[model samples]
Target: MQNKNIIITGTSRGIGYEMALQFANAGYNVLAISRKTPQILIEHENITCLPIDISDENQLQQVNEFISKTLKKVDVLIHNAGSLLHKNFTEITTQEFQNIYKVNVFAVAELTKICIPFMEKGSHVVTISSMGGIQGSMKFAGLSAYSSSKGAVITLSELLAEEYKENGIAFNVLALGSVNTEMLQEAFPGYEAPLSAKEMADYIYNFALTGNKYYNGKVLQVSSTTP
Candidate 1:
C-alpha cells in the first residue's frame, strides 16, 4: 500500500471522510473530492483535497486536470459520493428525481470513464450503494427516487466489471444498510443505526484494498440490520 494512489469522492464528512483519512494514514496518496474542501484532510501530508461538484460536467473536468498533473496512475477509485431524495412517489417531480440520479448514477459512470485511462489491471472501482437498492432485500416508502438511483448504479457496476475484465480492472458495489449518517438522519429521524460511519469506513477500507482480488462485478450487502 505504500505510495499507492487513491481517489475518493464525498469526503466532506461521514464514511467518506474516514476513508480519506484511513488511506492517507496508510501512506497512500489520497485525492479527496467534495463540494466543500475538507478541512481535516487538507492539512494531511498525504492528502490533496479537491472541492468540486461531481454532478457538474465542467467541475468534473477539473478532476481530470488534477490527475494528469499529480499522479502517474490510479490504484483505487472509490465512488463514495451519493445523493438521497426522501419524498413520496406522488410528490416527486421529474427534476427532483433527475437530481438524485445525476449524483448517484450518472456521476459514477462519468467519473469512472475519466479514471479508466489511469487505471491498470489491478485497479479497483468501489461504488457505495444502499441495501434498499437490492431488488428483493427490502423496500421502504419515500425512497422511490433514492433507492432506484442506487439500484441503477448496482447494475452499472456489474456491466463495468464485465467490460473492463479484459483490462483486469475490477468494479464492485457495496450495498450498505442503515448507518448513522447525516443523510440517514434526514430520512429517518431519531432512528438509531447499528453501524457507525467510522466502523463502516474501516470495513470498506480493507475491502477496497483486497476485495477485488476475490470479487469482481459483485454486490456485497454490508448490512447486519434491516432498514
Candidate 2:
C-alpha cells in the first residue's frame, strides 16, 4: 500500500518532533516543517524536513509552492507550532499578542488555505490547543495572551469544519492539558505533567489517522483528571 502524506509543523523538538517520528514509523510520508528543521528529522528517510517560518510571508509562500509542485495529495495536517508568552494582562502588548497569534492562529489559517487544493476527500486537519483555551475552565494568571490565541484556534477549527464540509474535510482541535514538553517547562517551571511528549504524540497520531470517522468540528480535551 502507498503511504499517506502528512504535513506537521514545529518538528524541531517536543510533541511535533515526536509526532513526525511516530507518523513516519507508522508508514506515512511526513513533511516536517519548522523554522529550523532538526537534523534528526532529516535523517528519517520517510520524513522530509522543510525549513520554513510559518509566520513569515515569504517562507509561507515557499511552502505553498512546494506543496503545489511536489505533493499531489495531503492526507493530514497537524498544526503544532505555537508561541506562548507568559505575561500579566496589563503587560501584554499588542505586538506580543499578535506574535503569538501569528504562529498559533494565523499560520494555521494560511497553511490550511493553501493546502486545501491538495487535500482529498478524506483529509483531516488537527490543531494543538491547550486547556487554557477551554471555556468555563480555570483561568491562570500570566497566560492571557496564550489562552486567547488558543481560544481563537478552537473557534477557527469549528468554523472551518462547517466551511469545508462540502469538500469532505475534517477540522478538529485537541485541547491538550499540560504535557511534559519544553513549552510547558517554560510556562511553569519545575511542574510535572501526567503525560510525556511521546505519549501525547502517540495519541495525536492515532487520532489524526482515524478521528474523522467519529468526530469533526470538535475540541477534544486530552488530559488526566486525577488530582
Candidate 3:
C-alpha cells in the first residue's frame, strides 16, 4: 500500500481515525475527511485531513477535484462514515428515518459514484457495515433504523461489485460485530468491551491490501471468531 492515494471518510475518531493512521503508517497517502480536523493528522506528511461532511455532495465534489488534481489515481476508497438512530421503529419519525438513510446509505452511494471514475483496475473499495445488518437480535430494543441502513450498505457494495467487475475494481463490505468504539458504546452502554478500533483497522487494512482475490463482493464478518 506504500505511496498509494486513499480517501477515508469519518476520520475524526474511532474506527475511521484508526484506519487512517494504519494506512499512513504503511506509507500510503491518506486523504482523511471528517467534520473536524483530527490532531494526529495535522502534521503528518502522508496524511491530509479535510473537514468534510459526506452527506454534502458539493463538498464531495470539491474533494473529488482536489484529489484528481493532486493524485493521478485513487488506489482505494474506504467509506467508513455512518450514523445510528437507537430508537424503535414505532418511535422513529419519518424525518429521523430519512436522516439515517441519508448518512449511511445515500452518502455512501454518492461518494462511491464520484470516486469510481478516478479509480483504476486493482483499486479497492471497502465499506464499514455492522453484524446487526446480517442478523436481527433481541439484545437491542431500538436499532431498527440503524440496522436497516447498514443492510442497505451491504447491498450497495454487492451491487457495485457486480457492476464494476468488468473494470476490475473490487468492492467489499466489512461487517463488524460490536467494537469498542464511541458509537458502539452509545448504542450499547452496558455491553463489555469488544474488539479494539486498532484491531479492526488492522484487519480491514490487511483485507483491503491482500484479500482482494478471495473476498471481493463478500461480507467479511469481523467478530470474536475473526483473528
Candidate 4:
C-alpha cells in the first residue's frame, strides 16, 4: 500500500502513534491528528501532523479543508482518539457522559462525515473500539460511560458500512483487548504488560490493508487470552 493517503486521529501517543508509524513504514502518506503534535511525527517524511481537537467542529472543518487541498484521495481513515472515565455510575455526572459522547462518538461520526467527500470506492474506515464494547466484563465498575461510548462506535461502524456498501467503501471496528498503553495502565494500574503497541499496530495495519469486503461491518477483536 505504497502512496495510499490515510487520515488517523489521536496520534499524540499510544495506539494512534503506533498506527502512524506502522502506516508510514508501509510507505503510506499519513495525516496524523491530535490535540498536541508529537516530536516523532516531525521526522516522518510521509506524515503530516495536525494539531487540532477532534471534538471541535470548526477545527474539524479546517482539517477537512486542509486535507482536501493536500491529498487527492483518502484511502483510509482510522478513528482512534477517545477518553476514559473511570468512575462509579453514581459518581458520573451528566456532563461527564456528555463529554465522553462528545469525544468518543460524536467526534468520530462528525469527522467521518466531513472526510467522506474526500473518499471514494476502496476507501476503508476503521474505528478503534474495545472488547468492553462487545461484552461486559465482571465487576468493571466505573467503566459504564466508557463502555457505552465504545458501543456507539461499533454501531456507527456497522451502519456506515451498510450505508456505503454501494459505494465500495468498507467500515469496520477493531475491538481491542488489553493493549499495553497508557489507557490500559490507567485502567489496570500496576498490572503486567499485555501486548506491545507495535504488535497491535502491526495486526491492525495488516487487517486494514488486506481485509476482504466481507469483513466490512464486523468488529474484529485483537487480544491474547493470556497477558
Candidate 5:
C-alpha cells in the first residue's frame, strides 16, 4: 500500500477529497486530479494535486505525462469526477446534456485509455456512478441528463472489464445512492442523505484495493435509501 500508485479524479471536494486524503494517510502515492486543487491535499506529501478540467481530451496529456514520469505503473484508477444538471428534461439545452456526458462518461473513457498502459496485473479500475444509473431504480425528474450519463458509464465499465479481463486488469462500477455531496445538494436541496462523503469514500478505498479478487464487470449499488 505504501508503494502503490493510485489515481483518483474529482478530488476538489466531497467524496473525492476524502478518498484522496484517506489514501494519502494510508501511505500510498495518490495522484489527485480535479479542475481546482484542494488545499487539504497540499499538506500531504504523498498526495500530488493536479488541477485540470478532465472533460477536455487535450488536457489529459498532462496526466499521461505525470504517470509516465512519476509513476510508471498505476495500481488503481478511480473515475470519480462527474457533472450534474438538475434542470427539467425539456429545459436542458443540447450543450448542457453533452457537457454532463463529457465529464461523466467521455472523460472516464479517455482517462482509462491513457491509464491502461500503466496498469499491470491485479490492477483495478473503479468507476463512481449514481443510483440513477441503475435500471428500475427510483428515478428523479430533473436528472434525465445526469442519470442517463451515469448509466452510460456503467455499460462502459462492463465492456471494458470484458476487454481487459484477459490482461489481468479488472473494471467495476459502483452505482451509489444519495450522499452528502455538493452535487447532491444542487440536485436535490434540503434533502438529507443516509451516508456522508467520508463514509462512502472509505468503502470505495477498501474496494479498489481488494474487491477485484472477487468482483469484475459488476455493478454494486451502494445505497441504503430509495432516493
Candidate 6:
C-alpha cells in the first residue's frame, strides 16, 4: 500500500489526526496537512506533515506545489479541515462567515482541484460534513455559519461525483454526528458524544479505501441519535 497516497487535512488533532495514524499504520503514504504540526504525526516514517492554513491563499498554493512534487498519484483525498463560528445568525460578521466557508467549503474545493490532476482512476474524495447541515434535521441556534458551510460541502461533493465520474473518480460526503473532539467541545461545551474520534476515524478510513465501490454522490449521515 506504499504506492497508495492519501491526503488528509486538519490532521493536527481529532478525527483527522486519528485517520492519519490509521492510514500510516496501514502502510499508505499519508500526507497530513494542518495549521500546525501535531507532535504524534511528526515521528511517523510513512506520514509527511505539512503545516498549512487552508484558509490562506498563499499557503494553499504551497500545498499544491508540495503535494505535486511529493506524490505521483493520489488514491484518496479527505477534506476534514473545518471551521465553526458559534454565534447567533444575526451576529455573524461577513468576514467570519467567509472564514468559515474558506475552510469548510472553499479550501476543500481549491485543494481538490489542485489534487485532481494527480488523482487517477479509482481515486476517491471523501468530504466531512455535519449532520447540522442536512435538511430535515433538527436545526440548532448559533450554528448558522458552520451549518451553511457544511451544506455547501454536501452539494459540492454531489456535483463533483457527477462531473468526475468519467474519470472513475468518486466523491462522497459523510454528514458526521457530534464527535468527541476539541471542535465539538468548543462548539458545544460540556456535551458528551456517543462517538469517539478514533471510532469515527476508523469508519472514515475504511470508507475512504473502498467506499467508491459501494457509493457515489451520497450524503450519509452518521449519528448515534437524531438530534
Identify the leading candidate in terms of lDDT.
5
The full ranking of all candidates by lDDT, starting with the best, is: 5, 1, 6, 2, 4, 3
Model 6, residue 54: distance off in Å is 0.3
lDDT of 6 at 137: 89
Model 6 Cα lDDT, one tens digit per residue, 1-227: 66899999999989999999999998999999998897779999999998979988788887678766778788999999989889998888999999999899889999999899988899999999999999888888999999989999999999999999999999999999899999989988999999999999999999999999999999999988868
lDDT of candidate 3 vs native?
0.84
Residue 137 lDDT in candidate 4 = 44
Report the Cα lDDT for candidate 2: 0.90
Off by over 4 Å in 6: none
| Candidate lDDT values, in order | 0.93, 0.90, 0.84, 0.86, 0.94, 0.92
Q: Give the TM-score of candidate 2.
A: 0.97
Query: Which regions of candidate 4 are displaced past 4 Å?
Result: 135-139, 212-214
Better by lDDT, candidate 5 or 2: 5
Q: What's each prediction's TM-score?
A: 0.98, 0.97, 0.93, 0.94, 0.98, 0.98
Worst 10 residues of 5 by lDDT: 35-44
Global lDDT of model 1: 0.93
Residue 201 miss distance in model 3 (angstroms): 0.9
Q: Taking the tens digit of each residue's C-alpha lDDT, what string does model 3 give over 89-189? A: 79899999988888899989988888888889899999988877875532356888888889999998999899999999999998887778888778778
- How do the residues 79-134 of candidate 1 rate in per-residue lDDT, one tens digit apiece? 99988888889999999989999899999989998999999989999999999899
lDDT of 2 by residue, 1-227 (tens): 24799999999999999999998887788999998888878888889888888988678888777777777788999999989888888988999988998999899999998888898889999999998899987778999989989999999999999999999999999998889999889988999998999999999999999999888999998978521
Point out the higher-scoring one by TM-score: 1 or 3. Answer: 1
Question: In candidate 6, which residue pairs get closer than 3 Å at backbone N, Cα or C atoms, i.e. clash?
Answer: none
The 10-residue segment with the lowest total lDDT in model 4: 132-141
Q: In candidate 4, list every pair of residues with a backbone clash.
A: none
Q: What lDDT does candidate 6 reach at residue 139?
A: 82
